[model samples]
Target: MRRSIPCLCLAAALLAPAAVQARVAQARIARMHTPVATLEQVQVRLDWAEHADSGQLRIRAGRVDAPALGYHFRDLTWTCPLRRTPEDGWQCEGALRGQGVAQRALALRGQGAAPLRLGIHFDVDALTATLAQGQARLALERRTATPDLTTLILTRVPLVWAQALLAQAWEGASFGKGTLDGRLAIVAPAAAPLRVSGPLRLHAAALQNADSSIVGEGLGGDFQLAYVGSAAARVTVAGVLHGGEFLVGSTYVALPPAPVGLHIEADSAGAEGWRLPRIEWRDGDVLAGSGRARLAPDGNVRELELQAHSGDLGPLAPRYLSGWLGVLGLSGVELRGGVDMTTRIEDGALVEVTAVVRDAGLHDPAGRFGFDGLRGDLRYSAEAPVDSQLQWTAGELYGLEFGAAAIPLRSGDGTLRSRAPWRVPMQGGSLTLSDVAIRPAREDAGADIRFGMALEGIDFGRVSKALGLPAFTGVLGGEIPSAHYANDRIDFDGGLTLHLFDGTVRFSELALERPFGTAPSLTADIALKGLDLARLTEVLGFGTITGRLDGSIEGLRLVDWTPVAFDARFASYPAPGVKQRISQRAVQDIGSVGDSSFMASLQGQLIGLFSDFGYRRLGIGCRLENQICTMSGLSGSAGAQDENAFTIVEGSGVPRLDVIGFNRAVDWTTLVQRLLAAGKGEVAPVIE
Candidate 1:
């Protein structure tokens, strides 16, 4: 029984081994053909139904692959369906794998849902790659229906070069509507250079390179560029910029708030070196031309040349380029002109420049008139640490007039030395003498002055009338031409003879300064032999002031544009036919108009000091100083017998009225106001 039992056990062992091998073979066949519900590493499990069911399948895997499509998935799990469609194509639907900073769940759809095309959508944030190879094209469509109004439609992008492709289109996506439509060729990792070249139309595009040291502005314009080589490599661009403005340093320059033209051709070397071949701009009536400005490796301007021009001077003259007064210390004046300038820059500073003003005009807003026919040349060299000297020469009076007198003038020359306190040295000029001449108009004062003047033949009445002064009406005619004021003091080295109303008078060497300070004082010596009083009274509006009127005004000054004290005397002379009753009112009016009357001053202080302030066969002498008049004699008091009369009525050292000739009378009210203003803080001892 033992031997028989051994034989039965041996038979049972051989049969058990054969049955185990059969079961293992069937299991292998099931795994090869059917989809698994879950799998890990080399182990997998399949769900088998006892009867027929739907072809839908659930898949879970640590790794999976479809060698037919060259796709691989790792650590993935998905629910999909495999069904045979009536068209004889298989259909699969399930969740696709997603990964990275971008969270994306791809919705897999095939021909059934794709309308004869397969489509996939991914909620991807970002993508990067190193290489790509494919002949098949891929198109992706993504949309966000809520939370944001962002929509993306992408097509024909390679996987290994995704990052470079996206970067090339970033600027176009930032302006206007933040949208971009363009084509680009990108090489990832830039083993050579990541070349990205394209023409992009932007709806809304903007760029901010925080890592860059310089900011790019006016980016809303049309752009076409090519980037080659490394991350900081060669670049070329050619396009027109419009509708925006930019700034460099603190100069805020803007386009005309409207559309402006821009033309550019630029190239760069490795991000740090660059040059512009030609850049031109045109807007309105102005044009600007610029040359290349290349940056050194040290980030400084290696070279630059920029120039601008405008046909109409009004636009840039007053605002950007103020001339003359801006150069001079004067105010309330502007200069208008066209410009031609060229500048060279090295190491970020202006090294040298040459500029010129073609034709310009000097305009005064205060109605002082203007001077045209102005042209000049200017040059500057910063290499010397000082502004370069400039010289200007001009000719012709474009349009010059003063008061009511119109004097024609010839050519003139001047040199403006640009030193510490710049100086203007003006030389030659000539003016035609008018029919009458007294004090020349302020604008024409020094026009025709010469070395020596002799008043041997000039009509004194004509002179007096032209100067707005009271007419002497005496027969004093002869030419007293030529006077000089170059040395600071006005000196008339001429003589005038007076023959009127049976009197003879003469003046020699008459010199005068406007003020006592800094100006050369006047020292004149005159002789009046016999002068008629009637004609003097008729012309002077005084009370029959009969006198020879022989005296000299020494130390005179009209420099204050006002008056000051001088020395004079008066004596008696015989004459007739002059008006007798010179009303005090008339005297006061004349004094106020002339604004330089001693009689006006005394009338306010000592009224009626002389009942009818007139002198007949009278003589007096006085010295004025320190605001006090030292009267030496009244009438015939002292042996001072000079027919010409002079009254020195002074108060605080305030100046006297600058009244020339007999028009020296002033109103009492006006005299008081002027005295008050001129003597606000000055007080002196009174002499009764």
Candidate 2:
């Protein structure tokens, strides 16, 4: 049985005089609910106070206690002042305050004309939210002062519905100071699992760490999501993101400083977890493909098929990770190729990668460095017992339009082994390397490359030009046919027939050794059949020295790529069929280019001592060691000589000026400069 006594109290307060009405207090609630199934106590308190003169009822406080909802609120207060409007609907200016106030202690001011329209502010703080609904339509708007703050507005939201949202946090995830808004429509009445569909938009969002320190920016998107249950959902988005982007934080990775356009769609019906049928992304000039990425219940991608293609690989370098753009010092590079692969992780690290590529072109301004055809299957499993390796074989490769050749490589267990560094041996040439091995010699060791190569028809002049060396005219009319370099020593046993100095010459037995950490040494015995010394001198940019010059440089050591020591001698041999004339200036110039103190001193002495010295010839022998030229056999040694031991015509000029080792053992720089000056006919007389 229930008794009705609340009418008397209400009537007394309503009929009270104006002076006495100010002392009355009342409490009311427009709506209230207490579900029978809830075990916890639930109560909502709404209090109203009216001012006698203003004729307005203000909601002074509200208390909602729902222990089951993790909500126990106290100190609830609100103020709503009544005002007359032009439409004759009541307008209320109110506020809400509670113990666990988040967002802010809101100042809620609203106007009701059938359906309510409310605007809320967090005191004098920099935040605003507005809500408006009429019949079935609903809307919300929110803004913030923070530049990176995001706003979300939701409409047609069902009071009771279950849904799930999935996101891949490439840089980790944390809730930001962003507003959330979305519209969700329940397809049927609320049940165990409800089907919902809606459009969601998030804008101007920034990503921050857990402590609210900004880590990245420009993250926002609009997407449509459909959910059949808490375990089943689909999301599609189009937006811009900085830093890094990923799919499932594991399957797909697009590293930062390189922007990628993201598009993806997935479902959960096929397997236990989300199954992605297709996902396509374009980053910089690289196109990435992902197909059939099946996820596990624990949000791990179980399987993935992916590929990447690029037309420019310069942007993919490690330096670009730090936003450095000017490091690569080249242009006109074009790359077009793709990798087809699948990957799986074990123990939370990259364990396996199997991929292949074809028709890859790496280019520069000069020309294209590319692969004619590439076919390979590479695999790497860091945790496997054998620790799988990477192997590659290509049909052909072209460098700078020189030609095409095959390249085969095998790498495994921290070692890279190649069958051949260049080309396969053909014709009279045979390539063979014995026990060639290179590895880290010690801790902190850089790369060590040890290989031997043999070649045929390899033009040394062309090699010198390609390697940016001072041009030395050589015989290159025929193939080498037999040249081998092993243990850092190169030996050319075959001859090259060359056209030079208006005559044919043969260069044979040219051997050199350039050991690691040591200078190169060469030895060659030159044979001149009918070499024109005048033309040879002219081609060498020196004054002409006539007659056939026969010479041999034995045990020539060019330490540190510079000629240091050698035993060289050239004689003015009279040709049997031709009578050749030798010039005195040519004699001086050859002596200068040689920078041979012995030659210079001898020339001065012989010229001073002899008048009209014929090929009543001249020859010099020097033993060069420790950069010092030691002259020997100076008196009548193997050439047409004058009647006197050291004379043709005695002039008594400065005692013949025979400088014993003069200017010898000089620094290489001074010697080189002297040689160049002599070649240019700019030689100065020795001061000492």
Candidate 3:
């Protein structure tokens, strides 16, 4: 009987497991959903199934559409086998695993009734709500109308793990493996202010984006944010940046390392809705700036007191003013030496800027503009003009070198004006600047200026040599009463006059487009009167032609200072005591227009016999466009419609020689080659 009893007990013990397992029922749900469920953008969907006997409810194919938060959760499954811990409580949760920052393994527990209480956890410690592994502790107190102060406390959570929270703040936010440690209290009540307060810290952070616009590396920061009023508009924030390199859409600011920190304290109150009363930045001992700024009624910077000291301008320019410098085509401009400046703003306008640079020097990568040993004291005031003096030991403009000179300046009306006319020596002559005003570059691209220039008598001989052009003997002078600079373009309102070849040549309507950038353009209208052809031809080596020449070149455009297009015409001025003669070589050079057949019938063979011929008149015109030159001659020949009957050198007396142009349209490039060939004495007489 005892053996039988033991056997019965063993059999019962073995059957107990099967009996307990048999009582558990599992079911898959299908197409069962609760419409209009709240909790932001979460959609609650469940498959209908009756596992009521087993106390289990499985939810499958759950998805949340949160487009506003830039998030999508798919492939979601929740298994909530009902337990008797609470009469109407559910432990519905699943491993949310997929792409993006929302991927996580969570266990959610909640009650199925009103005034709902829900809790979600990733990795929790024995201490009920100790967050870990991107876990969050959330609690909400609610009523029939709305919820109040939904508290969310997270610890040791990856910063990027809060994509939904971050998406509500900014676009395309990318953060690194930094842990977020903080408790955030938020309230969303109807007809009440949305209040949020928290002490947040990001540790060991390195954040960057696909576009280099919002990039920060090795960033560590803390912010104590408190808001008891309406949505963000009335919020106060106190933040401190320990160290980092922050790049915000073309502007990059970086902090060095330890005690060198950057602090920000801002509030929304007073005359201005928001103002920064304590803004400080420190970079070791090399750079430091502390300032306060108040926002205007429209939320722009209205008042400010900023003082900056830098041991080197080389780094400061790139870190702070790269955007503005790039607009001025001065990127990669090297600057060195100590710089100190104090600036003030009033009503969103610059009030004053007191700056002093010591032993400063600049090296331009473009080699167009640069200065060395620059010492300057600049005091600019909005109300009254100040005495500012600028001195440089050496300088270069457009690759031209000049000695050191002190330039005096004054300021008013948001412009820096020259106090007196300054003489800049160039080409053994003086270059004077008067009425010079300059509006410095700012963030909004509010930079423009107007100035006047007067050149006394600049020798063109040295100017020609300096410019690498043919030796020209003339006195260059000009009066530009209003040279305006705006939108990267400079236009001269007056003209420059040149006395050369016993004549006058004037240039008007001159403008320089993108003066310091790629392919600068110069446009002007040039008029010449009563010019000696002998001296001109001798200087240009264009084969001696003795005659008084007058010409006009309108709409002349030069790109990179090289003539690209023009409508030019030159002809005998018909003045007293002027002999019109064309050298034999010159006749051959001009006859090369058609060379053989074009000049054959026009004394081509006879032209080679005379050393020089007396011509009744001489005329030449070229209308260049689209790389083609439309050639013409004197009024009589210029208007000649016969294809091969345009006279170039009209004969007067015996031993007559008449050179004519037969082709009206010629390739400018080809004509230039021909002209160069003729200049080299390569013109050959082709007799047919």
The most accurate candidate by TM-score is: 3
On residues 289-318, what C-alpha lDDT tens digit does candidate 3 reach at each position?
Answer: 989987643344678899989887777776
Q: Rank the candidates by TM-score, best first.
A: 3, 2, 1
lDDT values, one for every candidate: 0.38, 0.41, 0.64
The stretch of ten residues in a row with the least summed lDDT in candidate 3 is 121-130
lDDT tens digits by residue: candidate 1, 1-688: 1011112222222333333333211111112211111123322222323232223333334444422112244554333433334443233344433221012111122233321122222222311111101222223221223311112222322222132232332222111112344444433231333455666443323333223332334445445656554434455555555444332322223444444556555455443555656766655554455566776443345678877666555545432333323322233555666666777776565566666666766665643345554555555554543223233333222122211212222211211122332222111112223222222112223322333222223344654564456765555533346565432356665666766556676666666553222332555555666666556655654434434444544544433433346455655543465422322333343333333243333344543343334322344343455444444323323221233333322122122111112222333345446434332322222222
Give the true-structure RMSD of model 3: 10.8
- For each candidate in turn, the TM-score is 0.35, 0.43, 0.70
For candidate 3, what is the TM-score?
0.70
Off by over 4 Å in 3: 1-93, 96-261, 268-273, 283-287, 295-303, 440-445, 574-578, 593-606, 638-641
- What shift in Å separates residue 105 of candidate 3 from its native position after superposition? 12
Q: Over the stretch 1-688, how does candidate 2's per-residue lDDT look in tens digits?
A: 0000111122222433432344444445433333101112212222234543323333322344432122434454433433333443223333334454322212111243332333333322232334343331223222234422223346432211101122221222333333334764433222344344566554434343333323433344455655454345554443333444323321223355544556666665434656676667656554444544665545455666665554444444331221211112233344445445665443333445555654554444333233334445455443442222222232211121234344444444434445445554322232333223333212244334445443344343554455554454553444455455554566765665655555655666777665322344666555555577767766566555556765555666666556677775555566776544434444454345344322233455445443222343444455577766544323444221323222111111332322222232345455567557766778633312
